[model samples]
Target chain A: MWYIAAMALSIGFGLSLAALAGAFGQSRAVSSALEGMARQPEAAGQIQTAMIIGLAFIESLVIYVLVIAFLLNGKIPAVDTIAAVMEKAH
Target chain B: MSLELPGWLAVAEEVFIGYFGPSYHESEAVFHAALVIPLLLLFVFLSTRRLEKIPTGLQNFAELLVELLSKFCTSLIGPHGLAFLPLIGALFLYIFTMNMFGLIPGFKSPTSNVNVTCSLALVTFVATHYYGFRYQGMGYLKHFAGEPLWLAPLMFPIHIVGELARPLSLTLRLYGNIMGEDTAIAVFIGMGIGAGYLPFQFPMMALAVFTSFVQAMIFALLSSIYISGATTVHEHHAAHGEEHGHGAHGAAQAPAHA
Candidate 1:
């Protein structure tokens, strides 16, 4: 029970953190692109492209953390089944 | 609280119904693979076989997809990206097709199964490094080793962990969105269990459809990004920094103005 509870809390916290980081990264990307456009609208195309690439890299990092939370939360396969089978054999 | 099938997959399945059967629910992966593979191949054949000097009908649609994906990939990976197009395009199409399968009446999405997504992600994960090595050669293995010997111990595990996490993240993200969307749709549709019209069902159904489209697009976009990152040389960053001057724009820029 405690294990599940701990997993749940961690997942909640990790997802929230991922959401926050994604929002910040996305906004920063948009803002930077806008600034570049304001300064040199002709470069908007290039700037926007770079911003998106950078934003994706940032988002991937957050997704990485989300993956960890997922594994911890038992969304990935758990060892319990294998352990139980072994215990039965013993 | 309630769920309904996405319209696109529903329409697709309606077009080719008995290609899938009621009893054959468990082997969703094979069913989806069979259903989508032909349609996708047909699309490719139709799109390419014409050799059109001027685009029309299927040719136009093919060109449009090509243009969109090429531009998107090139934007992220830079020029000389044409080489990676076939793999990236196939990945995106396969994922989106499998995801949309969930909305079909008798067909569950293969992607809704972790086993399926994991396999797909593993392929992408392997492909990413394969491309990385193809471009950079055995020297690409250096990325796993820290430049400074001192940081090697700390950085090596982090690098390994990060790479391992990529496939897991990709699989989970795709699985979660599709499964959640399908579950929501099912619940909404099931509300009609009691009532005839199923009051308040229409809006939920519409939202579920929208979610499906968004999730499909997100998966395609992210996969493209990963592929692009894998294929590109990191030298561009140094060149870009020199050109853009991230240092020049300093803290003098007002926070609110930003």
Candidate 2:
């Protein structure tokens, strides 16, 4: 029971933390890229490409966490199953 | 939360099972991917049937796509990058089509499946190293060895890990994003069914279109970057600092931006 609860909690907390960090990172990257484009509109294309690449790289990290959450989610048994196992153990 | 949209291919599978027994099972993703390939080939065949100096209709669309991809390849990978247009352009079209396929009723996005994305990433991984060796020969291994000769032992392992991580990251990134998007759309669709058949997922479908394009573009862009990084010689790497700078910036900016 405790194990299942912990696993569920970790998945939630892990995803939320990753989302928070990813959002911050993406915002910073877009802001800087926008500023650069504003300074040199002619170079906006180059800056935009760089920005998207940077965003993808950052986004991949969050995706890594999501994958881990998925793996952990799979490991979790149903609450009813756990309760039944506990009853049997008793 | 485990609700999933039923794909048309599932019905086909059922018919096959009824006719051929249980031995004829096939995944919907595989069916969708197979369906997409022939459709893509048919499009290419139709578009190229009659080449015209003054393009129109399908020919114009095909030419525009090729031209945009050509420019993107050249801009990112220099003149030599044109050699990779076939691979990059094919990836963009295939991935974009697969991503958007989920928006159609009774169809699923093949890209939402990790196995499909993993295979695509493997192609990029193999192509990257193949071009690396083709361009640099045995000297390509020197890249794993850092600037200081003493650092070779440490740097070699780090480089190997980084190289391996590239495909893994690519696989997970594409798989997770598409899977999440599809699942969201499915959940919304489920809600719509409960709400007297309101199209609750219409807005999500619009967002999916944007994300599908972005994801496809990113996949193509990163594959080109990886290939270019592997193929360019050290001399060109230093000389074209501005062009190479994007690769370095992409790596360095990750943590700082985060």
Instruction: Score each candidate by Cα lDDT.
Output: 0.64, 0.84
Q: Provide i-RMS per model in Å.
A: 9.6, 6.2
TM-scores across all candidates? 0.65, 0.88
* Candidate 2 chain A weakest ten by summed lDDT: A42-51
Which of the CAPRI classes, incorrect, acceptable, medium or high, describes model 1? incorrect
lDDT of 2: 0.84
Encode model 1's per-residue lDDT on B66-124: one tens digit a residue. Answer: 88877655654457566767766777777777776666565667776667888878887
User: Which is the leading candidate under lDDT?
Assistant: 2
True lDDT of residue B170, candidate 1: 70
- Name the regions of candidate 1 deviating beyond 4 angstroms: A1-90, B1-24, B199-213, B234-258
RMSD vs true structure, all candidates: 9.1, 4.0
Q: Which candidate is the best by TM-score?
A: 2
Report lDDT (Cα) of residue B133, candidate 2: 95
